[model samples]
Target: MPLRAEGLGKTFRSARGAAVRALDGIDLSIAPGEFVSILGPSGCGKSTLLAILAGLDKATQGAAVVGGKPVTAPLVDAGVMFQRDLLLDWHTCEDNILMQFKMRGQPTAPHRDRARELLALVGMESAAQRYPRELSGGMRQRVAICRALVHEPPLLFLDEPFGALDALTRENLNTELAALTAHSGATVVFVTHGIDEAVFLGDRAVVMSARPGRIIADVRIDLPHPRGAHIRELPEFTAYTARLRKLLAHDGRPDHREGVRP
Candidate 1:
């Protein structure tokens, strides 16, 4: 198995006695080296699902299995990135990237070299010695990408990693990230609210319904990879996005299926 979630569900108690259901019966299987994106509206449990998948939080209800084993806690094999790079302001970019190794308390010679290569991979090798304050927003995100890949994780979980950037910058990074994920052969589960971004980066965009979030649409992008910049200008891209929008516009919820206890 690459990463599989079976009957995943979560309910949290608020200040009041009532409970809020964040996710409901989310069953997803990401094949090894595939790129998949989770798309949903705000407060639709996209991040909550990502947290569960990343092993940062446990599902109140199901099981997550990775590489044929159950995911009981955070797994080092999957790297994670969020909206913010969250680099230490005082540390040089290279040092900040290397922090992943320090956190794991693992030996670093080979991984350190790999980190530098990752920096270069994102076109930030020259900024390796510079501090976060010295880099622009896009550059900081580039460093974040390098940091996420430094450990050479077989899987990557990204939660709105480009949500804060300007449109042009976000587009640029989207292209770069697609290329990098392809080059590295890492399976990716990305979360985003932007439909265009979902279409551009994901091999298939999985759309979730509002509130008690669950998969509502699984739209495949049939375009070839190493996708050229002009691919988005094609009619097929617009058609797929329009179809997803139409599906989401409908009010139906996912059918409850029987599975192992969550």
Candidate 2:
């Protein structure tokens, strides 16, 4: 489904009763089946924007529309993944994914085969019976992805899902995610601080400014799909990353730039 944010703005009151603006005059449209990466400074409201788009939170002003309807509540057809795995410690890996179905009052048995297939896609099939406590950080995140995807939602939101992993693991999962989503025909909005990651995963990398975030640049990534790790070595990939870094550096404050590096 396509997503549209019209004149979107968000404001929050601080503990001392001060109004803090997070997003302002943000107008964005994401086409169906498009993977758009939102890159911005640390406090630039990236996560807040994702929340509004996913209908998890309401915009202080304007509206968030999905398909042809205005979003007023959490979308039943949307799936969300966060930096933390948020898996149940007592549940096994496969069970964690099945929990998604159970939460919706759906039958888990019908989805079991697909859940195993997703685990196999992430090379976690052997770990299906392993508890979250027994799995590594990356493994847990893999299960999180499966859980988010098992429902076959047309839209997926990921908020720095790989941000907490080690360098090598992060890269590996990035590649896997690219490959996994290539043919799934799902529209994805990925929010991240990593410039390379934004370039690597996004069809278009939308750069946002600091606090009271507004989009400053939207650069289309020209690289081919089904991108592997080797795609990162391409000159085009480097150029996209470089351009994003420069955009962030020019639009972001010195302290904010620290969170935007590759």
Scored by TM-score, the top model is 2
lDDT of 2 by residue, 114-162 (tens): 9999999999999889899998999999999999899989999999999
Cand. 2 TM to true fold: 0.95
Model 1 misplacement above 4 A: 251-262
Candidate 1 clashing pairs, residues 3+ apart or interchain? 61-262, 62-262
Candidate 2 segments exceeding 4 Å error:
252-262
Q: What's the true lDDT of residue 147 in model 1?
A: 87
Pairs in clash, predicted candidate 2: none
Model 1 / residue 164 / CA error / Å: 0.3
Candidate 1 per-residue lDDT, tens place, 128-177, comes to: 88999988999999999988887778989999999889998888888888
lDDT of 1 at 192: 88
Model 2 scores worst on lDDT over the 10 consecutive residues at: 250-259
Candidate models: Cα lDDT each:
0.85, 0.92
TM-score quality measure for candidate 1: 0.91
Model 1: which ten-residue window has the lowest total lDDT? 251-260
lDDT for 154 (candidate 2): 95
